[model samples]
Target: MEPFMSDLSALSSALAATAAAAAPSLVSVHSHRSRASGFVWKSDLVVTADEALADEGEVIIAFADGTTRPATIAGRDHTTDVALLRFDGRDVSSTPLARDVPPLGSLAIIVAADQGTPVAALAMVSKSAGPWRSLRGGDIDARIELDTGLRRSSEGSLVLDASGRAVGMAVRGPGRTLVIPAATIERVASKLETHGRIARGYLGAGLQPVKLDEGVGAMVMSLDKNGPAAAAGLRQGDVITALNNAPFSSMRGLMRELGPDSVGAVVDVAALRGGEPMRVALTIGERPA
Candidate 1:
């Protein structure tokens, strides 16, 4: 059913007012669907250097014209798809995420478009290292769940705090959404802008930690050959029993154990090749994209 004009007008008014008041703090970017390629810049966000985003993925902005843009993909970290982009920053206005940044264990609510406009919502801070999720019919993860706000938000809406500081950017979700923290985004932006993409090392394997069945060794899934694991002969289904002789129950533990140096160093991978206990010493490769 068509939304009542009065309701749309009210919402537009509220959003417009908020944006107008905060426009100085936000950058506005304007791009349009080009008959040739994709979207061409109609305009860019204009803001002081202080207000300019650090160059991470596209920032969601309010257009003075009342139109919305989805987003442009830029420097993406394979390990973390946190990217950067320029936006049609003309109407640029947004209430930043709150300041008292959510604690390490605090919750984050990120709203993005499900259909058209954003519906307010929340997402639990799964762990310090994300892929944050917003569960359906379950207690909120980040103490934040969409209260029906994702619909109007584009993929790049900034999730703000009560005071209007940016904390999280809405990226993806079903009931569970993926958001890149602002802090992480800031760190990745400069590099992305300089390189047009993320410039992280490559480790070609996609590995997952799983509880092995009795008699089964460590379990690895989501194999990526170009990753460190594959470079080190770590193949899919290669059950990991030990990393550098450290017994790990989870992949996070394993990754932590390897750390950054693992990118170029060789590590002993103890595993059950096929029910027979064995070991394969492979050199860790670069961080694969």
Candidate 2:
């Protein structure tokens, strides 16, 4: 019991130190519709959860020094749940992204100060894997989930490694805490600030993975009404074997091939319809905003 108490005390001190180090970049985001946490991304750009800034109105950013400034939503990506705000105030120090993230099971800290002084919670990297899609179909470059439960108000807090380098941002899931990797945030934020939105190719089809002779391909379970797939004469149960000569290993792979770069471009699609192989020229459509 004494040993456990000592470990807990040491962890508390470590987390406090981390919070202090990251406090300068942390800010409280307040709006009539919502209140959450955010952090400085660049000179005058702040990043936060997209859901927190979904409300249409002005937002206030309060710093640790008690200075509040007005900010406007510069861009938002509902797919990644990331939103960038252009601040109408002085420049601020931005948090540094860790060159190499901590390995799985390494200690991490979540820092946020929605109202006053910054606070932190000790956690561990529970999952770290390859690129995947969010429940909302956001293309995440990496999978990072924390082991600790975070407060809903800490939705956009900066997640840091033990060395105090920024790793990601906290986001509340159905019943878990997910971290949007720093690399993804940096890439998405840069594009959002420049383009106001990320353009993605839309197939307008609901797909699932199906077993092929030796590999996996996407099977169209359903098609969007009057969408690109429908316009291309694709029907339900058609197994898409390849796109542009690249074998479709999974639905994710197919989606990757149909990225923003593919929007509006006509490509050859290989599929199996009713056990017969066929080809179709599909003009990819722009995903709805």
Which of the numbered candidates is closest to the native, going by highest lDDT?
A: 2
Note the Cα lDDT for every prediction shown: 0.45, 0.84
Q: How many backbone clashes does candidate 2 have?
A: 0
Look at candidate 1 and tell me the lDDT of residue 279: 76
Task: Give the least accurate 10-residue stretch of model 2, judged by summed lDDT.
Answer: 250-259
Query: Residue-wise lDDT of candidate 2 within 93-133, one digit each (tens)?
Result: 88877635568999888998767457778888988888887
Candidate 1 lDDT score at position 202: 37
**Please, what are the lDDT tens digits per residue for candidate 1 over residues 6-58?**
89787556554443443333323323321100111123422111112234433
Q: Count the backbone clashes (under 3 Å) in each candidate.
A: 73, 0
The C-alpha local distance difference test score for the whole of candidate 2 amounts to: 0.84
Q: Score candidate 1 by TM-score against the native.
A: 0.49
Candidate 2 residue pairs that clash: none
Model 1 residue runs over 4 Å out of place are 1-17, 22-62, 66-72, 78-81, 87-99, 102-149, 171-179, 196-215, 218-239, 246-262, 273-276, 287-289
